[model samples]
Target: MTIRVADELLMFLPAARRGPVSRVPSDGTSTLGHLVESLGVPLPEAGPMTLGGEPADPSTRPDPGAEVRVASVPRPQPVPLEPGQVAPRFVLDVHLGTLARRMRLLGLDTAYHNDMDDPALVVQANEERRVLLTQDRGLLRRRALWFGAYVRGSRPDDQLRDVLDRFAPVLRPWTRCTACNGELVPVDKQEIERDLEAGTRRSYDVYGRCADCGQVYWRGAHGGHLEKIVHEATRQVEAAGVAK
Candidate 1:
């Protein structure tokens, strides 16, 4: 009923050390996944598992005094698809509001709201088949979540880069509203003439309108700033992902 987590995984433990942990039942039977979870390290934190040095999955049940080991994973594994389940999407926690906007800017369908509570966030992630993205380790441990990732970066650019490298979601820039997560559709400049500010009208011609929020978008001087961010983020993620 004892378990030894990998050194890399020790961060997930309160003690942060490899050791014998868990309370064994009188019958001496405890599943590896359950034992790992009992130690405050979620199953997702363990990469490869083994019983007596042989390869095993999370479901393997070990007898008392059986040696169980867990390794660290680069990222959480995708949840196995179930019948009637929708395609997986990304769900950002409240703290990642800026990263949410960045992901939306890249045309990824990201779901986020700064005011959402933990319970509601978990529900949305589970019910919608979304991959919960957060820096909170406890939130990522929620058993209800089918797929989740721990954000390792502090800044928006670093976080966005980590996400892009992890899930490798399709990147389609300028198709979503940065202010609101709405799809941007092409609009004739004349169609939104009245909506445009005087400066915008005089400086830009092409336009896009949010189908949901009715916000107008045009490539203005600020477009260069956005392009630089996107270009830098893409380069960082891609460069880091290349095998050395």
Candidate 2:
């Protein structure tokens, strides 16, 4: 079978296989998604596919001589949801702690643990019905995972952008605990005065505390930097006409 890939996906292919089209001796048994993964492009990073010029799903099996075309996942790609969810929630791998915090800052429900093993992570993803976010292609290839996506870029900021651009989840900034993925609720300053340092107590009046973790938040010196991230993401989603 001949597989044609779009230009955006060229970077994931091996140098010898890097071309507009690749001829693969198909097994005629494996699904198109598996074939694409075998070619080094993770399934989540891939976009829509066409088989013989007809739209096809990843599970479609191709004949040995059929032509297949693949494209990169488009910006503002809708997040896949499980039952009972209004929006996509995420479970991030250990290495993505910073990205997790950033996502939580945007009030996205992000679950993360620094020491969770692959098996554990998969279990959490399945159990919680969260979209697994990871930099590991191997992890993304796991069959048992309910849903997942490959996180592009190295730096946390760039990775955040990649995710935001790929799946424009509704943003509710400052409504979640960056430290613990808990819902943030308004807390009277008097109720948490003992937890704050003297300077913090004097400088900030409005506050929100995590309902689950009890961590407090206020607009402090770093607020501007965080606000910039929020504004940029909001603008991008608005520009793409994604729902708030």
Q: What lDDT does each candidate get?
A: 0.76, 0.89
lDDT of 2 by residue, 84-163 (tens): 76668999999999999999998899999999999999999999888899988889888898788888899998999888
Q: Pairs clashing in candidate 1? A: none
Cα TM-score per model? 0.82, 0.91
Q: State the lDDT of candidate 1 residue by residue for 1-244, as single tens digits.
A: 5577777666676664445454444245656777787777766567888888899877777777787777777542344555854324678899999999888888877899989988899899888777888988788777787778887679987898777766655467898888778999999998889877898899888889999999888877778888987787667545654632
Query: What ranges in model 2 sit over 4 Å off?
Result: 82-84, 242-244
Indicate the residue-level lDDT of 166 in model 1: 64
How close to the true structure is residue 177 of candidate 2, measured as C-alpha lDDT? 96
